[model samples]
Target: MHRPACSSYLHQLRRRLLLLVLLSAISAAQGHADEFIYNSFSGADLSMDNQASVIDGLLRLSEGTDTKGHAFHTFPLDFSNNPIISSNTSSVPSFSTTFVFAIISDYDDLSTDGLAFVLSSTNKLFSSSAAQYLGLLNSETMGNESNHLLAIELDTIKNQEFGDIDSNHIGIDMNSLISNASKGAGYYTPDGEFKNLKLNSGEPMQVWVDYDSERTILNVTMAPLPSTKPNRPLLSIPYDLSSVLPNTRAYVGFSAAAGGIPTMHCILGWSFMNGEAAALNYSDLPLKSIQQLRAGRHTYKTIIIVCAVLLPTLGIAMIVSATIVKVRMMNRLSKSRTTDIEWEREYGPPSFTYKDLLAATSGFNDKMLLGRGGFGSVFRGVLHHSKQTVAIKRVSPESKQGMKEFMAEILILGHLRHRNLVQLIGYCRHKQQLLLVYDYMPNGSLDSYLHTQDHSTTNICWAQRFCIIKGIASGLFYLHEDWEQVVIHRDIKTSNVLLDGEMNARLGDFGLARSHDHGADAHTTRVAGTWGYIAPELARLGKATKATDVFAFGVLTMEVACGRRPIWVDGANGEPVALSDWVLAAWRGGSITDAVDTRLDDYVEEDIELVLKLGLLCSHPSPNARPCMRRVMQYLRSDAPLPADLQPDNLLRIGVSQELRMMSVERPMSCPATTITDLSKGR
Candidate 1:
């Protein structure tokens, strides 16, 4: 007789639970020394600092007074120390700590300074420092590179001189008062919602700081007092502390200061441990929980029995739920791919049902197809509700890179509001199908007007074309230098440039866009962008710099002016001639106007010649030789003069030939040599 399926499943689960119980019992039997330092400040033995008094069962680090003072608590910090913060060649030690702290304002509704948990090589506090400096370091000591210090600041007062986010923020500082990474005071709920917690509420709050040295990931979790620990952390950031700290030995203590609006800084229970130690949970703290009598020697027995019984049931429940969800999703995906209406309310964007899109485009008929790209296909659609025309990009399921591009478009374009940048209205993520909706450009991509034989129908006037050029320059300037960070539009071409209702150019398609820190040396191993648009140096080093984006813009500029693709076949010799080379050759021959599109006979000769020369200058092979987008904009607007040495030989030979000769680009010797690889192709 064969065993029943249900009984067989339960037998397997029982075996797994029994093995888990045995493992738990073994772990419980093992004993280790309690090497952690913990203090609730309930006894007369003042360990942290003699100056810090135990007042009302709390450690008072500072009083709300104007008089400057300093205090520090230190222990034997060396290799022999139990909880020493150490860094070695092999691996850095990990630690976890938790503490309850309160910063009370001296004046009504005002707190002047803040407090910090500092880890330093020395035990001494900066005596000259107070208020804004937070008693950590003085001006002279801060300027020294050897002043190795790391601090986690719970700031209650804004220091305008130091560019703080606001009065309420938690920041990680290295050597200086300025924060390396910071965030406004908030705690995350289990449902992923952020709840703002006031740091100056006068009420104490619990903070848990954990570092996994192996991963170099630091997490900060916080919650209002008397509340259970938050399942999610407020801040989880990556930082390698070993690289910044001086050595294996360091002192860890608290520092506070009083400014014009003085405040009291107090710490109520504190605990610190090293070597992947776990801190006491917030719910288990004496301040938050009721004391319960424990039956001697049965703690391990009770935990094992409870876990063994609960584990199997919990595992089975989870499996059943997951199976049901998968079945339902598959059914829904096959029958009707409509997105839930609740998504609009949840994310604060107008929702377009997948069914409505199907109806709008007649089930994605070929007639509705506008264009196709590496990631997805764009279709013209009309919203049935508003009857408004729109362009929808249906990402291909097989395109693994399309999902990233879809999300990038939503994140970048969703918030960016610009006259020259395309607007992202809404998006849909239903199973494997991803889609993005944007305002329809009836004129279609600029590539069709420039390269295709359909130019006769579009017939873009030189005035409009010049405006398009200036418009693109302004857009590139915004992305490269104006916005908060340097947004490198990795793919910039005539195809990505869209025209609006008034025939004004709008730079669209930010799938390959990357926001780089200003003044930071940025390099990406995963090189992205269209082939011809990618910069020459990118081929050698595989780094996407601001210069790379400028190079692409230069190519697009030439393409718009000459009404030709970056790489096109010559009519006379049937040889491929890069637009940049053709323009440079024409300029050398002393008839640069001949390079302008023949359709633009009514164009101004000098203006056309200026644009052509600007293109060559921008698309220069040398990344350093290329002008920044801001400078390019100025030159285009006539606000700045072109260089005196903007001659053909000088711009082409030194900037192009010399740079190209050393590069590994596909077409190395070709003027403006380029390779056409899709952004999705791996480097």
Candidate 2:
């Protein structure tokens, strides 16, 4: 009997699984960390053909050394390989990410090390970190044995000898130590060498984790070290990412819950296959169950045949659907608000003839280049239209988010026309030609004055600085309060804030910013934005709100007052007194003079206190406690005594300030040793 395609497919899948088992057995001769699926966080295939399994994990997106630190999110991969961070996609879909999670750490206590994979059906963001899961529970120290979080405990050393699990074990948690979801199933997971893993060595390890949105299951595997091969399997667990998907976006990454028994685990790298490659439903399927596979050969053959057909059919369906989805997604690119210009209608960004920009930028030459970001380069160009000089942001389109972000920038910026926001002049809407045009800022960005640029602003005296700060405040106020549609400037770093010839601060780079409103900040899923300037709330809760932006302003205001970047601080040469901490301390000591820009030493004590107070109030520990932009202006313009009690100590206590030494994102940045594929090769 030919039987239906469904039965045939099930048989095929079973056969494939059996084949894999046999192949794995034959290759058992190899060792761990041998088969590497190189993931550099560049926009590419998540699987990399590595065939790694996932338990509970997400991808490692490189944030590229923001002012403070960086991390990435794991998500249901989109049709275009971009993780689906928004819920605004096709509903007729099954979401699954390949590879589970294993957080690597050399620390003895698991609670001391922190990590989590946030799930949100609403907010398309994921958040995670190694040392401490910052502010997750709000009222408890890390590893305090009581919190509302899930932890993948990779305790290298035994702290809880009386637990039902082993030292190097895996278990499900609900954010606290007292209530473990794992039954008697926890045990010491042995690596290929059968040696105990040490998370305190400051060494890195490779872990595989996967999530199925349809079935709500998670699977995991781990190697003692990064890229372990030849059966590097350590532990595996079935989980449901959708269980918490309501709380976060589809992007995935590491997250940790800390309590009394601190431990450490780090996710060295990660990836998730685009929209539902194949999910095995163990509850319903006989083939997925190991018991069924180990059954009689006749049954096994039937199941294998079914699986082979099912898997191939599923793959083909996914490919076709994903292609159609991509075409549809690319078809309705956001229309330019003002379409009277024929140039935009005919040739949009990434498609606009590069030759035009080449002539404008003088052929991508260094002199015309404006600057570089985590994605690609920017240039200064003059459009023959109106013969006006404008800035061109030329992205590599290879960075994980290049294409989508380029489109987003074009869409949102094209519609926005605020004096404080950079205006989008035009875009090149081609697949290979990634470029954007904006009104040029001859003074460069705020960073040029604070750092990077060798020349200080000859025009920016104390009054100018105050004006600049107020200008930035105005722009921020527009973004947060005034705009009809509230926009969160996710990355509010100095580098992102531009300056006109008059030194007026204008917010640039809407690439990371998102539209958010009240009551939406508490459950953020995809945690993004520049580090350092990112609010403490973002670190604890992935949500970005007006208050979150306010927190960043606090960090930014500190920079403005000191004329320095947030990365540099007053102390922490040895002690914990960072710039923010010291500011509070100084305020408390009644010597608010210490928070002034050393250049402003000549200024009166009261003026310094005004700026210092503003910075401190913005940096308040509680988001609710933070004053709004309107109130902030009232305080800045009028001498409101700075809050002596405003809390800046929390960030320090949570170890967020000591991020470099703990997380140390300053490792040498790796780039393609050389660029081989030059689009300008034709030239």
Per-model lDDT: 0.69, 0.50
Q: Write the per-residue lDDT of candidate 1 for residues 43-81, one digit (tens) a residue.
A: 523334323555545566666433233334445234233
TM-score of 2: 0.44
Query: TM-score per candidate, in order?
Result: 0.49, 0.44
Off-target runs (Cα >4 Å) in candidate 1 are 1-315, 318-351, 454-458, 570-575, 654-683
> Root-mean-square deviation of each candidate, in angstroms?
24.5, 25.0
lDDT of 1: 0.69
Q: Write the per-residue lDDT of candidate 2 for residues 1-683, one digit (tens) a residue.
A: 65788898999999999999988977763321112232333342333111122222323211111100123342232223223434643321234333323332212122232333433222211232222232133223334432224444443322221132433444444444322433221213334245544433334443444444444445444444323332433443545443433333233333343222222233334434334323222232111222221233236445545554464455555657577666454333312222312333323313235677778888888998777766789899886533568898888857768766776676555545455678666666444557887889999877667653543443356776677777777777766766545777776767778888778778888886676554454334666765556566566556778888887788777777776555443343533234566576666666766666665534556666677667767766678878888778777777454456644444234444654344334532122221212211110
Clashes of each: 1, 118
Model 2 segments more than 4 A misplaced: 1-353, 452-459, 517-523, 569-577, 601-604, 639-683
Best by lDDT: 1
